[model samples]
Target: NEVFDNLAMFAGYGFNKSHSAAYGMVTYQTAYLKAHHPVHMMAALMTNDADRTERVVRLINETKGMGIEVRPPDVNASSLDFTVAEGAIRFGLGAVKGVGHSAIEGILQARKDGPFLNLYDFCERVDLQKVNKRVVETLVKCGAFDSLADGPLPAGDLEALGHWRGRVDAAVATAFSLGQKKQADRDAGQGSLFDVADGLEAGPVSYPEASPWSDQVLLDAEKQCLGFYVSGHPLDRYEEELGVYATHTTETLERAAEREAVKIGGVVAELKERRSKRNDSRNAFLTFEDRAGQCEVLVFGARYAEFEDLLKKGEPLLVQGSVRIEGDEEPRERKIICDKVQLLLDAREELVNKVTVQLEADSLDEATVCELRDIFKKHQGDCATYLRLRVTLAGQAHFKLPVEYSVRPTDDLLQAVERLFGRGSVSLG
Candidate 1:
């Protein structure tokens, strides 16, 4: 009995020592690889966790923090797994939702002859039976064919065929129709006169004109197909406002003091509502994402009721909350208890007091000043305007405009000013 008890104890405790040693060695090796080969390691890590969208997003952010760029999926460039391209990590086609292994294989086999020249060329060459319309549309929506769309075209062709998602989508349908006809003829052993005549060719390709998608629309499409934003985040436009108004970022909230009051700004990445177990009160949890990272915000009882309308996915919100850290663990569970919330745009309008336009002395011609005056008049409001003129050797001069010249510093006005003066010319205070 004593011997059996001793053996059982050893089996339970002594075996753990060997297991711990093995784990320790593996941990050390992984840490070493991450420290030295961060890009390669992160690429592998991302590929391994590609099925987990949330984990992939976290890894992508970590890769960026390590000074490694994670490029979007490209049908012409990416393989089935994440690949290293010019010191950056290229996302894999296999990671994209709705693109199956067979579809990727078909795309790869078709591209072996050469890189796809355009959407038409891509559709014509690839086996449409495998790389179907839905697969092609999903790839295009997620920016897999962005390189092809953005590539230089023959002289006047680009202006006539203006490359936008809507145009690309229309072109895809036309290309598929032509491809199907050609395939049908070939299968039937019938040849057209143009096929027999080497000198003859098809006419120029034309795309239907469409208004370009807004940044929000593009991001939404990316999220739909890729499970996350690859090209850009929706909150990117509110960067300046977030910087000025937000007291904490999702990343910085980890170190927030217990029950500390804070203001955070981000788009609602996710929202889940439920009834509280104790009181049967409606409560909700929001996964908020900014440029830095993501955090959870808990809205309970009256707070959920007050902010229910604002807790919508993809909507930018400036949240006033207090941190709630549970336990004293190394990586404790942290969440924000929502106190109040408001639209990010509304917060920006209420907070921004001044707008400054920086101009080079040589660029300040009569035409430029007249355009600036017209812009101010077009957006007339209460925000003060100032012009900083940069002169060679004499230093810059700041001139505040009269109260009548003050204008509303809305996104449209800012965009107009940027379009006229170029980026980095305008600042808000």
Candidate 2:
């Protein structure tokens, strides 16, 4: 019995040592690949986890952090798997929502002759039966057809249709009509105008006038179709404001102290309302996303009732809460227990009391002064304005504008000021 026990102990130690050695070798290999071939390694990782949206989002962010760009899916460039293109990663079509393997195969086969010329050409060439209108719409929304926008339009074909995406969307029906006719003609073994010996061809594709979608609308469409933002985030325009007001971001929250009071700003990515069985009190869980990533914010009982109206999805919000940490595991579960919530725009207006613009002495000419006055007049409000002039290399002067020159510190007003003077010229207090 003693000998058997001794043998068992030795066997356990030997197994543990061998396991550690194997794990250490794998770690070394992974680190070497990450350092030497970051782009390829990241592309492989993203492609491996393409079906998992959350994992893909995290990996894409990490890829960006490594100074590698991950371009959106392009019908002209992307393949079934993520590929390295010009030292960057091109998103895969297979990962795109609403696009099946068959659709990808059809697109790949159709584009084998050459690149797709335009939306009309793409619709006419591909098998519309397999790559249906919904798939095309999803691709358009996710920016796969953005490259085709650079193609030249026919002469004298001018319209007020907003952006290239807007024009393409408006012309989808007409393009589909033409594509269907061509397909029917081919199936019937009938020659179309293009097949004629003469240089006869179809008329130019025309797009109707339509207003462009807002940035938020475009971003929402991307999120709906690709499960993440490709071109830009909805909160991108509010970056400066968030930097000034937010005390904690999703990335920073990982290291935050338990029960630490914190203020965070983000767009509400998702929301779920629930009722307690014991008292039937209402509560809610919100998936809040900032520039870095996403986190959960919990609003319970009284807090939920106090801010129920403001807890809307896709709206930017400023949340004040305490970090609640549970478990002593390697990755502890963390969530924010909401104490207060308000619209980010409203918070900016209420918190900022002063706006200061810095200018060089030489640039503050009569015309510049007039433009500044016009900007102030356009956004009249209660926030006080001050001008700081750099008179010389080591000398400066500060002047407080009269109450009449004061203006609201809204985004438009700030943007106008920055545009006139330059970025980093306007600071809000």
Candidate 3:
């Protein structure tokens, strides 16, 4: 009660100056350390928050971007906590969720003189009671035993590890039962009734074929140990395609506040609809997250309707617009005022909202090209209007624009041509 009373009083009338001073010193220390030595900082950070999910993830992201490689937790190589070696951050086995630190330490210390080369070697040397099946399973899931066994596929290691853990469990149970029977049999001078199952001997146990898991599976495993993904970013898969339309990364956009006609990319996290208090009009408020951080954007009037369906959550987008600085308007609010919201990959092509099909200029039969034109003339599909033809292959031989044609280059048609005609023969121009 006394402690609570003191805390309440301090909370109500805290000394901001003194607190700020203390906080400033700590902040400076952190900044200085981070700028000078990042790997040690990351390893220590991982140790402190070995159970947290997001913090560790953020740290991992920050660390990797600094060129420090975070190797996955391994049975033979890893220490109990994260370690900094040669400017790289090694994943801590003990940091993995569900695996006990004591068990991890036991395994590490057992292999201190050397690494366990195979499954049988691991079982033979390791203390089964301390570093049991559960610990081994965590290692396997995190690709800890990649150095030892050759599983069927890259992913077969996990399956093999799971199977082996089950066997280890069964083996322990049988061994306990057998030991009890042996004691009784020795006293009675006869065999006991129990026939204990020792399960499969470690040497004969075959490793399952392990195929590599999809991106999501690998991420989940990373999440288990270091509190976040240490191997790859979730956005890495779409980054290349997304880059085509996105003119600026998060960092560049933040610095682009004063520039005109900025382009930014992100995954849409939220969207809100609103009506103006002054008049009957529609607008959208958007929140998006890129690799760096979150930004809020606003789309006013007709543009909102143009991009309504695209504002859905988890939809990745590239937005081209002006940065709305705070106080730029009366009683101003800070935001990005969007001129356009679109798929970065889809929007940045030379032409947009239109599909173009290009035929091999040299290979195309002149009759076929004319036939394509005649067919389009018969069916007037005004909805899809963009078309292009490239014909000059010889040096300085200029392109000859064909007759004005309107053709609906649907996705199906593009895919069909790409599949049938092969790579160079067709392109979504």
On lDDT, the candidate that comes out on top is 2
Candidate 1 lDDT by residue in tens digits, 66-179: 889888888899999999988999999888989999999999998898887778777767888898889988987887876775544342221222346667876778888877
Measured against the true structure, the TM-scores of the candidates, in listed sequence, are 0.89, 0.82, 0.48
Please list all clashing residue pairs in model 3, or write none if there are none.
96-225, 152-209, 153-209, 153-210, 154-210, 155-210, 155-211, 156-209, 156-210, 156-211
Best by TM-score: 1
Q: How many residue pairs clash in each candidate?
A: 0, 0, 10
The lDDT per prediction is: 0.82, 0.83, 0.61
- Pairs of residues at least 3 apart in sequence or in different chains that clash in candidate 2: none
Indicate the TM-score of model 2: 0.82
| TM-score-superior candidate, 1 or 3 | 1
Candidate 1: C-alpha RMSD after superposition: 3.9
Candidates ranked, most accurate by lDDT first: 2, 1, 3
Runs in model 2 deviating more than 4 A are 1-28, 151-162, 193-206, 355-378, 385-402, 412-427
Error of 3 at 118 (Å): 3.1
